[model samples]
Target: MTMREIAFSLVAVAGLLATATAKAQAPEPFGRPGASDAKGAIELIDPKVLRVCADPNNLPFSNRAGEGFENKLAQFLAGKLGKDLAYVYYPGATGFIRNTLNAHLCDVVMGMPQGDDVVQPTNPYYRTSYAIVTRAGADLDGLKTLADPRLAQKGRHIGLVANTPPGNVLARLGLLAAVKPYPLVVDTRVDAPGADMIHDLEAGAIDVAILWGPIAGYHVKRSNGRLVETLLTQEPGARMSFRIGMGVRHSDQEWKRELNRLIAQNQREIDRMLADYGVPLIDEAGAPIAVEP
Candidate 1:
């Protein structure tokens, strides 16, 4: 669940893991012999510190520069726990959880889908959707769905990540020719598809793009009011929104409980933080959340 970035797509993560250098020359997985890992023993909890496993270069999520929202969330939680914050850095490309959290290098991973089967997930802290991005004043600015027939018109180049939910919708609509595909797996160390998609949209290389909400939000905010991102909540067929939470080992029930409590107690603050980053939050009814989360 490098995302659920918080990649709502298991396909994307698997693609990255399959393509990255995780398979060859990768060491045998290592962690404390008696620790909670494949053996499922009790995890070693350092009550004095919060160690997080994060991609060193992913932004609007986490990065070594401490600018991503997950970095800020980690800092906030560590303060709430009265613990020092620490990080175990790696590219999120492949074998990330296996090398870090599963190896006992870190205790938590922010931005996972709530019910993902890999790591035990915490209570959802926020919910977001994939979104459509376009130039602020452009004709596609108010676009709400891939089913929009306007999309089939000539000259509407779409920059979409391959194999995503919206991609499916587009395919069903027979608008494949409109798409200028973006890759599912790239070196997050130096390449960001979301940013690149937004850049292309801005530079008119592509007239439209569909991307994860958080990624779209962050870049759009930095675009000097030149872009707009509309939530895909109204789309049909493909599920576009999901709840996001943190991840820990299954054996860490107490840890999960504590995190759940923190989430419950400070959800409003968390909402504000995500909103500041421009994340497109949704509610249970699949509507855009009110300004107040």
Candidate 2:
């Protein structure tokens, strides 16, 4: 063969080898369903869909129309990732994490409290304080906060949902005598009617109620301005606010890291969402006492 022909053959072989190498190094498509990559903002596979588990009837958190604060956050995440939002609804009851997210039925939980709970939380998106909800037109003028000594006075029954951190906190503070325990009826579907407790409150069966911020806020709003007076409490340890965050499966470290980044970048928007839902702005300690109007 001529020298030129030999040289040409060698060049062609080298070009073919380079092409093959480049193709091999390219990233494989994302394995999970509904993953995406939006212009390199985050490394996601195409056709991304964020499968979020949420409650269908719970308000100020999530609902069927995706109107809740967490629902909006999920939508925002989907938009940030350039993916579609898919929801799996289950009442936010007990065993939700284990039965749903842990079971791999959904990829994320919208509002898991940050702590050593069933699932791990990403960075907190919003903070809220426990508020004291009372019957409409009731006098909270002297209450000031949960630490008010008047709460321990006779005839003032504090209604608390059963088996929650607040209930436990109340017990630790030596306030259990003043508390009227209402079996937790949400999420667990324990055959107890939450409305019964509320009814009892309306009938003057209970003078006060201590519930989580979201639930309290929701009840106050739904009362149509009738259930008046919410006092921000300063009960010891009650001052410690629970940080609600998104939860991912324990094995999803990569996904969790990505979610934390997204939360950090959009903290302001998240705060606004919580507020728009009537979730009171809380301090680091989670008490709703001194939030600016």
Instruction: Name the candidate that leads on TM-score.
Output: 1
Return the top candidate by lDDT.
Answer: 1
Model 1: runs farther than 4 Å from truth? Answer: 1-42
Question: Which stretches of model 2 miss by more than 4 angstroms?
Answer: 1-47, 168-178, 185-203, 228-233, 237-240, 285-293
> For model 2, what is the C-alpha lDDT against the true structure?
0.56
Worst 10 residues of 2 by lDDT: 14-23
Put down candidate 1 lDDT per residue, 142-190, tens digits, no spaces. Answer: 7887888789999889998886778778878988899999877667777
**How high is the CA lDDT of each candidate model?**
0.72, 0.56
lDDT of 1 at 156: 80
